[model samples]
Target: MQYYYGNQMPLRLLDEAEFWKHQEAEHTEVIREALNGLEPEYVQALKEWEQALTETHQQVVSYVETVNRMGYTFEELQEQVTELIKYCLDESLKFIDLCREIEANSAAAKDNPFAKTLLNHIIRESEYFVGIARIILYGHTPA
Candidate 1:
């Protein structure tokens, strides 16, 4: 999350969204792989999450390709990029909620120290993305 794209906020935000969403989708597999004895409900939930995250990741990738190819300045495409950022923000928040639920409610997650810690880490990563998205969309983060 570098502000290196001082004039390319949309590209920067899209790149971030693309990377994190892909990571999150893979994280679902990581969790699934680690917890062989996980409950069926939790496993199914993770599978659904993986699919959702992957779809979001692909959407972000499409945006990135379009933005890079079109060469539009941030001002030219701010509205569309803003909508994308908002969608990403909502997705990240929902992901954090799901991770928190697993950490708090899943017996499998509760019993495995690794899974619990990993869930916390995953939530923090999504929160970090949310914070970045807020800063970009609102020009400042709320206190």
Candidate 2:
């Protein structure tokens, strides 16, 4: 989670966001690979998610580089980074919903227990990231 970074707080959170978004993007492929007979619609959705997550991951990485290059988190960029964290949190929540939908409605996923388990695992991981992001954005007690 790495939430406490003193002056490098934004950098730390950005690092976490980058890693998790990349993981989540890879998770879409993991779901596709785990489910042998996934519906075309579901597969297409996962592919889109992968692309989106990857783009978000890249954005976070860019922020991380900016922070490092500047040697500290400036006020203007800090606000933007905070918004980016919020966006990442929202993206994670949406990804979780998509995973839940597949678990509940996908015919191929229903036939494959491993995919279901993987989905659950992936959802939990994303939820953890959400909790961390909330802590970073809204403090220990998020509304």
Candidate 3:
């Protein structure tokens, strides 16, 4: 009774914190089982998505640190901050698009545990980036 891409599917088990905890776990058993009968292309796409997520996360962190220690005159810091904000916005948009793509491709599939996990990670990382971006853009820490 496993569902595929085009099949109607049941509501996912949604225990927000627990679901995220499961995703954060290094246990690959669920992913391995899910991928056991899938196509190589899906596997390859999943790897690419994971790499993109990691790279984006690193870039956001580096940008935030750089902006924090800019140590420049007002005008110079302003310009640099503008550029950093633009970069963050672009990265955020890209991250959101990737999440949407993953959700669309895997939502109906019962064997998409890996995709689900990756999506959850991407979402959490994206939110983190957004928070940092806001702090940089607004000069105010979130309350």
Candidate 4:
């Protein structure tokens, strides 16, 4: 997973608003592909969950944009992003579980690795984001 995304832009350099927009679009595409082989009816919950993710990403983007346009600091955006990371951390666990379930049920394509790859990426990325978010929002210290 690290090799896959190693050369990507460091999140620190990202314009939060633009980053969220790109991430949101990427997520939509990835999820669409991931659900490709699942039975249509079986994907309703997944579709709804994907939509909710989109909506949240949009909200975060909008908030960051507004903050950037004004002469304001990103303090609020930090809190918002922290919350988003927490939500994503939880969702990533569920996503991994659902993929495992689908694979166990033999509903997923055996030849296509797209869904499995996406879920693994989500899990690793979520863990990284959660760690970064925690460090930023509450400094990590040796306990």
Best by TM-score: 2
- After superposition, candidate 2 runs with Cα above 4 Å error: 2-4, 141-143
The Cα error of candidate 4 at residue 6, in Å, is 25
TM-score of each: 0.90, 0.93, 0.44, 0.57
**lDDT score, candidate 3, position 116:** 68
Candidates sorted by TM-score, descending order? 2, 1, 4, 3
lDDT of prediction 2: 0.89
Better of 2 and 4 by lDDT: 2
TM-score of 4: 0.57
On residues 1-143, what C-alpha lDDT tens digit does candidate 1 reach at each position?
67777778788888888988888899888878886677788889889989999998999889888888988888888898889789988988887888888788888788788888888888888888888889978878878
Residue 108 lDDT in model 3? 38
Worst 10 residues of 3 by lDDT: 7-16
RMSDs, each prediction?
1.6, 1.5, 14.9, 6.7
**Residue-wise C-alpha lDDT for candidate 4, range 6-97, written one tens digit per residue:** 22212342243335434544554565566567666446655665676666566656655565576344453555556665565455445556
Candidate 2, residue 45: the lDDT equals: 99
User: Local error of candidate 1 at 132, Å?
Assistant: 0.9
How far residue 4's Cα lies from its native spot in candidate 3, in Å, is: 51
Q: What is the C-alpha lDDT of each candidate?
A: 0.85, 0.89, 0.45, 0.51
Clashing pairs in 1: none
